[model samples]
Target: MPSYAVTGSSRGLGLGFVQALAADPSNTVFALVRSISSAPKLQEFVAGHAHKNVHILQADNVDVASIKTAAKEVGRITGGTLDVLIANGALMHHERNKLMLDEFPDESVLDDDMLTFYKTNVLGTIHMINAFIPLLRAGSTKKCIIIGSAIGSHKLARRTEFTDNPGYAMSKAALNIAAVRYASKYRSEGVIFLTITPGFVRTLQGTPEEVEKFFSEAEAKIREKFPSYEGSITVEQSVRDQLALISSVTIDRSGDFVNRDGKNVEG
Candidate 1:
């Protein structure tokens, strides 16, 4: 059976990916969540499935010691061979403090707020891959999937009106570069690193209702400034598309900025 590891599987798009992967009879999914008891949906899904393939491991991304311990546990389970690994945890701290830049540009990035995002989005992801590198190397088709966003695309920023969150966008952009670099270094070992943007998905992190409310307040101003605003997609649709793309990944396709639509996204 193919063994898979995914971060942030407690909820949102991560949970969607876990569910889809678990549906496959030949796959065993190791979901790294913050807390098992708090995640009723995840617990329910795993329980109702009546299969032991779905393993939920507690993981606080910011806690390096916790991640290391969990990695060791997973290493034992898979015998140091993991087929798939996903860096899917993310945060949008900038949304709450739009004036943060104006108030504290110099101190903002270094503050606890932005540092938390980096710890989870960037550093934590690095730790996950590094600790699991040995396991991935032992697998047949070693693939590392890094969840990114269209907002991080430098090309999109230059041409289109995609996103305005500098902290979140910049972090993802940096992640893309790191992913590409990792892919280039390991391409010879049949390791595929795919940087993907799952699209604007409505997930547990932010409900569609909340997004609607936000849009109602800020949408007109955004639309007035940038005349081309493509709306969001459902979480299910985005997850399906992302899973399809991940399924088709190969060494030749590594280090590419890919979107849910199977086309090359610029960055």
Candidate 2:
């Protein structure tokens, strides 16, 4: 059986991954979230679908101990083997969507935001990989995937002149390099590490008005960059495309930062 563990599986793209992966009875799916009770949708899906292959485990990306504990639990269940580790948990400050770096009220505020972003987006991912690598090593297809952002690409930023969300973008850029470092170190072992962007996915997290406004603004910027770019896609389609890309990726393509279509995003 193909064993897959996804972090931040409470909702959004993470939940979509769990749902899709669990649809196949041959795949063992581990859904790691910060709190079991907090994920009502995930709980409902598991209870409603009764997917025997799905396992929900508590794991906060910011908490190293929790991740390690969850990894141990997965090891116990999967016999110390994990085929894929999807590092999808991240801190996305939607409220600060259009805010520029210099637009912050003060340096202290900027520092706090940057530090928080780094803690979750960069450090947390590193800790997660460190914790679950043992199980991954024992598995058949050793693939480590990081859900990255196009905003993190220097080339994209230059082309679009997208100067907002500096902290989040910087963290993702760092995450891409971190994935490459891991891929380089583990290349001889046939472990694959990749950072793939999910593209503009309509997660619909905020209020109706807020969601509308955010998408409108985001779409405008995206179109400005790529005139032929279509609107945002549903979580389902995004996850589907991402899964196909994941299945097709080989060790030779490891360490690449690419879009959902597996096209490289120039740094």
Candidate 3:
């Protein structure tokens, strides 16, 4: 069986990835969740599955020491080979702010929130990629997937059609840069690195206003294109599409920021 590790596996896109992978008979999923008890749905998922390939791992993306320990444990369990790795943990402080940038300048508490965002979204991604590169090298198909956002696309930002949480936008942009550099450095190692923007989806990271504004506009676009846009999409739909892209990715196509639908975003 092939082994895959996904961070932030307790909910949303991460949870969907774990479930989709588990449905495949040839895969073993090592799900890294922040708290085992806090995720009742995920725990129930593990319980409902009859397969012995599912493993729930406790991890903290903001803590290097915790990641090191989890990596060591997973290494021993998987015998030092991970077929696929997904850097899926991230945070957006602006989602919690009711004040706009003007009133929220101080509401953000920038020093603390920015540091947290960098630690979890930026540094954590780097740590996860570095820790598993050795194992990915041993797998049949080597891939490192980073889940990014369109707001982070420099080109998109320049187009005036994009908007997002300042912290998340900047952090994901940093993540893309890191992934590009890593892909270049590991070209000879055959470890393909790819970043994907999953498009707008209902997730746990945003406020009511932010969510309403984002999805309302996105839904409008979908309605414009498809006409039957009842706004229906399972989390699995997004995960499966991105995972398919990641699984088939190569150095020739790596380092390209594509959307969930597999179109290269202009960047």
Residue pairs with colliding backbones in model 1 are: none
Clashes per candidate, residues 3 or more apart or on different chains: 0, 0, 0
Task: Report the lDDT tens digits of candidate 2 across residue range 134-164.
Answer: 9999999999999999888988888888788
TM-score-based ranking, best first? 2, 1, 3
Per residue, candidate 1 scores C-alpha lDDT tens digits across 1-267 of 988888988888888988989998789899888777877888889989856689999877777887888788988988888898988977754544464334554674447666776777888888888888888889877999999887788887776554446667777888888898999899989889998889766663467687787655554654565677555667788889998888888789889988877688862
TM-score of each: 0.88, 0.97, 0.86
The C-alpha local distance difference test score for the whole of candidate 1 amounts to 0.80
Model 2: clashing residue pairs?
A: none
The number of the candidate with the highest TM-score is 2
lDDT of each: 0.80, 0.92, 0.78
Once fitted onto the true fold, the runs of candidate 2 whose alpha carbons sit more than 4 angstroms away are: none
lDDT tens digits by residue: candidate 3, 1-267: 888899988888888889989998779899888777877888999999977578888777877776777777778987888888888977754554433234445754765666677888999889888878888888778888889987788876675443336667778889989989988888788888888887665664468797778677768865665576456355777887887887677778677778876688773
User: Model 1, 262: alpha-carbon shift in Å?
Assistant: 2.4
Better of 1 and 2 by lDDT: 2
Candidate 2: residue 115 lDDT (0-100): 89
> How far out, in Å, is residue 16 in model 2?
0.2
Error of 3 at 194 (Å): 0.4
